[model samples]
Target: MTDNPAPAVVEPIPKWHEFMVPVLRVLSDGKPRTRRDSLTATLDEAGMTEEQRAVMLSSGQPKAENRIGWAMSDLTRAIAVAKPERGSFVITDLGKDLLQKNPYAITQEILRNIPAYRDYEPQRQNVSKADPVDIAVEDSELDPTEQIERGIQLLRADLATDLLKRLQERHPDFFEEAVVKLLLTMGYGGAENRGRRIGGSGDGGVDGVIDQDALGLDQIYIQAKRYAPDITVGREAFQSFVGALAGRGATRGVFITTSRFSAGAIEYAKSIPTRIILINGKQLTELMIRHGVGVQIAKTYTVAEIDEDFFE
Candidate 1:
């Protein structure tokens, strides 16, 4: 074989608008179709090549498939299709009537005309333009530049959820260490003020602590939990944590869990005299992901615009 191989030819992916009508048509019968079936139906009807199907996005999702997914999302937003179940969707009565009219192109203009889409307009910037069709093609909820940021935000959310699941699988000691590392990432401690994991050492209710200053005058106690979602942290846990802080003669504490806090738990934390910060499963993962404690940068892209100052 030659050292140089021919570059694989990449095929084009259709825009979101191109997939809208096909998605509507696939769901028009009112029979529930699964997510995979729906995407396949649209792509098949549109006659995309295998090369196009094989193309992958930076997020590892197929570009054409992602755009098709966006089309289905747009349809659901317009109430053109109803997702009555988790993975499957059915055409609503409104959707059926819409299919009967047979719009040549079920464009965003048609979608925005729906009352639900209009209801969201008050919060959006007032862009008084005569052409509704142009808004769909030209205007982005976030501009084209911002679309990159939006995609990265979505990717990070998926990664965070995965990291939380993995964290739950680890040992309690690991969880305590992860929280300390996360705190360090959040600027809680530096060379002068170091954090320590004390859970495995039979430390009291407190699992870890971060000395806030070099002199160690102030410290933040941590109580870490690797509980599942079904296991909610109740008020008792918070009260015990407060008692631990009292034992340490400390006023600041952080209660972190890989599960949600019960309503009573949240209330008790607020009512406690000590400063108790609650970090539930969702919040914990978000913080870790934000501070780069458990995750690493996969890729980076720099987007630049014309510097107005340079032009002046």
Candidate 2:
């Protein structure tokens, strides 16, 4: 008998908009239910597999739960669902009418058509040139929170691409210095941030070093490679870095590159006795963004919500 393969651990959960109809159906009887109970009933009614229900967002909440909550929020904004009591929801007359019309599915376009939903939308000074229909369809897939996160993700990805390209265009010495500054910003060079680039001729294989304390009793070695995005730093490169560390009698080293590392190089670093951290092009750019090394924030947004404590 052949053994069956393991089931896939993660599966795509329904998008926030897709849950609108399901949430409405769960409350169609007009009986009020707590948010927790409603979500559980909706989950069962949707016939989601265990894997789908088990998926989680980066924030650690279950993905299905978050989407369902957003759907309920949208329905509430449309005057389709009402919270008769705190944490308890019931279908309103408008919701029942909506459900009767859209038994199988409800699109964001239909919700936007409701004057209440449009009125609740945040007032914006800029008007989009895109057709309302197309915009509705495009925005329906992700909830508002997700839409914001996805927008930021896309912007960061574009910035990373541009940052990597710019890094590759600079002199090799510049990259070495940049990595050193990144490490210092990351708190590796102590309070004084004492670190520098030592990549010129006759210097050791390492490009940079960080003095963690006054006497330099603790130090970190860094190797920076400004290879093109398509290039892969292989195991031989890691071997050279390792040899350099050994020559210095050091135990910790960081290898930062504006390119990817081969699988062999990663495995080699993992198996070695000396501690080695690998930072590839993607990771390097992300670190640069996080540390505010080469980028500046253009804007900031604060998402506020009702503070129930003040009412009490």
Tell me the TM-score of each prediction against the true structure: 0.59, 0.55
> How many times do residue backbones clash in model 2?
0
Report the number of the highest-TM-score candidate.
1
The regions of model 1 sitting more than 4 angstroms off are 1-141, 307-312
Off by over 4 Å in 2: 1-139, 307-312
Superpose all Cα atoms of candidate 1 onto the true structure and report the RMSD in Å to 1 decimal. Answer: 10.5
Residues 249-290, candidate 2: write the lDDT tens digits: 999989999878999999999999999999987788889999
Tens digits of per-residue lDDT, candidate 1, 1-312, equal 659988888767888778877887888767899999999998998888889999888879988899898777666655577656567877877777766775557766675677544422222235453434253443465677656655665466455545765787789989889999889878887765489899966688889999988878889999998995448899888889899899989999899998788899888777867898998877887788778887888887787889999999
